[model samples]
Target chain A: MARLSDVIEKFIKSLLEESEGELELQRNELADYFECAPSQINYVLATRFSVSHGYYIESRRGGGGYIRIVCLDVDKNNFLHYLVSEGIGSRITEHDALHIVQRLLEQNYIAPKSAGLIKSAITDKAIGIPSTLKDTIRANILKSMITAVMAWQGK
Target chain B: MARLSDVIEKFIKSLLEESEGELELQRNELADYFECAPSQINYVLATRFSVSHGYYIESRRGGGGYIRIVCLDVDKNNFLHYLVSEGIGSRITEHDALHIVQRLLEQNYIAPKSAGLIKSAITDKAIGIPSTLKDTIRANILKSMITAVMAWQGK
Candidate 1:
C-alpha cells in the first residue's frame, strides 16, 4: 500500500507537471480534498518537497494564505556542487543520502551502477565506529568523492 | 528453472547484495518465504556460504536470536588479508573502507588523488540510495575502482 505522504507527493507532482513546474493552492483545501489535516500537507512538504529534492516552497498562514510550490529547473552538476559544499553536514541520515542519489539517478547525472557503489560505502556497519566519529568521516568522504568525479568529467 | 537449493542461495545472495556484505535473519521466516522446510535454509547456508567462500556465519537457536552473516575482509591483492578481500562486499562501512584506503596510501599503492577519488565515489551520500541498496553498489564501485587503479599501475 502506498503511504499517504507518497500519494500526496505524487498528486502534487502531477499538478506541477501540468502547470510548468509551479503550483499555487490553499493548504486547507488540499488537506480537505485529501481528507487529511493541514498538518499532513505540511509534513509532506517538509520531507518530500525539500530543496534537496529540487523544490522551492512558500506558504502564507491564516485565511486566504496560498501555498506556492516551484519545482526548480536545477541541473545535476550544480545540484551536486551544493550537495558536496553545503547540503551535507558532518553526519547525514540514510534517508537524505538516498534522496540525493535518487535525484542524480533520475536526472542521469550518474550511472545506476555507480549509484549503487556509493551506497555500499557509507553504511553504519561499514564505518564500524562510535556515533560521534562516524559523521565527520562521512562528510569528508562524501565531499572528496563528489569533487573528484566532477573534476574527472570536466564539469 | 533453478533448483530449490539454488533458489535459496540466490535469494540469500540477493539479500546480501542489498545489505552490502552482511545479513541477519530468522531462519524460520526465510524458510517460510521460500516455502521450504527449515532444514532447507540451514542446508543452503551451510553449503553455499561456507568459510571457503569468504563468509563468516554465526547463529543462535533461541527466541530473538539471529543467523548472522559477515562478509569477511579478503584483500584482492593478498587474498588472505582479512581487511581487504573478505571485508568488502555489496556494502562497506565508511570506517573500514577508509582504513583500507589509508593503508593503500601508506603503502604508496595509491596516490592522494586516487584515495580522495575512492572516498567520494563510495559515500552513501554520494550514492543517494535507499539503505537496502546502498551497500551493494558501494562494494561494486570500490572493487571496480581498485581494480582499475591496479591495472593502470601494471601497465
Candidate 2:
C-alpha cells in the first residue's frame, strides 16, 4: 500500500491529466479518504504542486468547498522541431519572452551567453515604438523568427 | 552635517563600484558608526539597495557574521545577442515558449503575426504531446530556433 501522501499526490496528478481547465478537491473528503489530517493535503499541495513547479491551486471554505489545481504543460524536448514548422511572423514583448529564456537558462537547456543575447535583442529600446506596444510586438516577432529557424533546421 | 543614513548609502555604493563581485558589511558596525539602531542599517539596505534595483543582499547573524551584497549589471541588449549565439534544444510547450516570443515582440525585435503563428503552433493540440513535457520542450525549441534564425540573419 502507498503512503497516504503519495496516493494523494498520484490522485491529484491523475486529476490534472484528465481535467481541462482546472482540477478541484475537498480537503475534508480527501482527508477522509487518506485517513489523515486535512493539513496533510495542504502540505502536499503547497510543496508538490506550485506555480514554479507548473501547477496552480485554489481553495474555498464552507460547505461544498474544494481545492482546484491547474497544470502548465511545457515540453522540454522536441520544442525546436515545432518552432521550425511554425515560422517567425510578428512582434514579441520583453516581459513575456524573458520568462521563456529565464526558464530555459534555469534548466541549463541553453547557454548563459545565448540567454543574454536573446534578452538584449528582444528588449532593445531602440526598436522605436509606443512603449505600450513594444513588448507585445517583440514577443510576436521573436516567436515567428524562432519558429522559422526551427522549421529550416528540420529539413 | 551629512545624515548618517546618507553616509551609509554612499559607503555601500562605493563598495559596489570597487568590488568585482558582491560586497559584504556588518550591521552592528554600520549601526555603531551611524549612532543608530541595527534595524536602521537594515532599513537602508532594504530601501536603497535591493535585488530588484540591480543589487542582491544577504546577511547572517550570530557571532562575527556580516551582510553580503552583489551588484548585477544586467545589460539587456548585450544579453540577447549572447543568447542568440548559444542555443536552446528540446521540446517545449506553447505557454512557456510564448513568453520569449512576447518579450521579443514587446521590444520590437519581432513582428506581430509571427507571434500569433508561433503561439498557435505550440498549443497542446498542435504539438500533440503529454502535458508534463510540453513546456520544457517548448522552451528548448524556442531558444534553438531563435538562435538559428538570429544566426542566419547575421549572415
Candidate 3:
C-alpha cells in the first residue's frame, strides 16, 4: 500500500485539478476524511504543497479558518524570473531546490534532460561542502543557472 | 605583458587553428623560441592542451622525437558517451570539470545556458562538502548530468 502521505498528496492534487488549480478546504475536515491527525494534514501541505513546488498556500485561524491552495499560474517567461527574484532566497535546502526543478518540469518550462541536469547539479552529493555555507552557495548557483536559461523561451 | 603561459597558449592555438587542429613541433625548439625552459613548454601543454580541454598530446623522447597535438574530432553524440565511459574517472577537480564544460560549449554540443548550468553545478561553491570526497562526488554528478543530456541530440 502507498504511504499515507502519498495518498493524501494524491487526493489534494486531484481536488486542485478538478477545481482548476485553486481550492479551499477545512483542515479539520480533511483530517477527519483521511482519518489522520491535523498535524498530518499540515505535514502533507508543508511538504507537498510548498511554493517551491509551484503552489501557494494560505490558511486562517479560529472557527472560520480554511486552507487555500493555488497552483502557480504565470507567464512562462516570468515564472523563472520570479523565482530568481523572489522565490529562492540566499539559502535553500536540497529538498526545496528539487521541488523547484520538479515544478519547472511539470510546467513544461524545461525538458527532461534539462531537469536531470539541474537535479544532478543541486543534489547534496554534488554540493559536498561545509554544512554552514552549503545552502547559500546552492541558492546562488541555482539562481545563476535559472537566469541563464530565462532567455530560452520562444527560441 | 601577457603572461608567458598565456602567450604560449595563444600561439599554439593559432598554430592548431592554421593546421586544422593538429600540430607537430620540437618541444625544445619552441621553448628556446619563447626564451623559457623546456619544462615551461611541458607546463603549457599539460595545462592548456589536456584531453578534458578537447585536446590530446603525444610526446616522444630522444633526438628525432616531436610533440604531437590533436584536437578532439568525434561525432557529437559519441563525445559525451566517450567522456562518461573513459574521460571522467572516479574523481575530477573543479578546474578539470570547468574545462570539460568549456569544451562542450565550444563544440556547440550544449547551449550557452546549458553550459552555465553545468558550470554552476560543478563549481566548488555548489559542491561544498569535505575535501576528501569532493572530487569523487563531482565526477559522479558531472557524468550523470552529461548522460542525462546525451539523448537530447536532434530533438
Clash number for each model? 28, 104, 5
Off by more than 4 A, model 3: A58-65, A85-91, A129-133, B1-82, B90-141, B147-155
Q: What's candidate 3's DockQ score?
A: 0.18
Instruction: Write out the backbone clash pairs for model 3.
Output: A127-B127, A128-B128, A128-B129, A129-B128, A129-B129
What is candidate 1's lDDT per residue for A1-155, written digit by digit as tens? 23677789999999998999999999888899999988999999998888867799998878788999998887667777888778886667655665666777656776554454454445454444445545555565566566775775642
State the local distance difference test value for candidate 2.
0.58
TM-score, per-candidate, Cα-based: 0.53, 0.33, 0.55
Question: Per-model TM-score of chain A alone?
Answer: 0.79, 0.47, 0.76
Give a tens-digit lDDT track for model 3, residues B57-141.
6555754678988765536557786887688988899999999999999998888878877887777776555466678767877
Q: Give the poorly placed runs of model 1, Cα more than 4 Å off.
A: A89-95, A106-108, A152-155, B1-155
C-alpha DockQ of every model: 0.14, 0.05, 0.18
User: How would you class the docking of model 2?
Assistant: incorrect
lDDT of 3: 0.79
lDDT of 2 by residue, B1-155 (tens): 99777788898888778876467788888788778999998888888875334455555565557788766444543444444323333444465566767877787755554454445444555434344645544544355434333332322
- Every candidate's CA RMSD: 10.8, 15.1, 19.4
Quality of candidate 3's docking, in CAPRI categories?
incorrect
